[model samples]
Target: MENLDGNIDLKIKEISQKLKELRLSRGYTSYETFAFENELNRVQYWRIESGQNITLKTLIKVLEIHQISLGEFFKDL
Candidate 1:
């Protein structure tokens, strides 16, 4: 079986790419703007999107900022 770290790293990279695509689709061309609009600091948002440790609450907030439903967020890719 893949190691735990490896599995998490793969998942994080996958989710991070999707988040970035979603942001781009919304015309959030500026990272600072996206962060500010979402009420999250740059570093925290970076960590969350980049697949660093992210709280469930943070994920929920990010999804909400993009006006994406929780069900959609969790939908299979």
Candidate 2:
């Protein structure tokens, strides 16, 4: 169970890293700016990038904003 928990943590970190990378690729140095421009809840977006648990709906919304499918998003992770 401990190992499973560790794996979940690692995946969350990976997802957060990927989100940050995507934001960077879009030329937004500040997460706040990105969130504002996208009309997202800035604090929540920050939490997502900080490896906090996010809902599937939120994840899909972000992915849609980035024009990426789940397959592409998780491909390298």
lDDT of 1 at 72: 89
Query: Candidate 1, residues 1-77: lDDT per residue as tens digits?
Result: 56998987887777777888888899988767899987789988777667776777877888888889878866865
Backbone clash pairs for candidate 2 read: none
Candidate 2: stretches off by over 4 Å: none
Q: After superposition, how far is residue 15 of candidate 1 from its true place, in Å?
A: 1.3
Q: Candidate 1 — what's its lDDT? A: 0.80
In candidate 2 the C-alpha lDDT for residue 49 amounts to 99
Candidate 2, residue 10: CA error in Å? 0.4
What is the lDDT, from 0 to 100, of the residue 8 in candidate 2? 99
Give candidate 1 regions above 4 Å deviation: none
TM-score of each: 0.81, 0.98
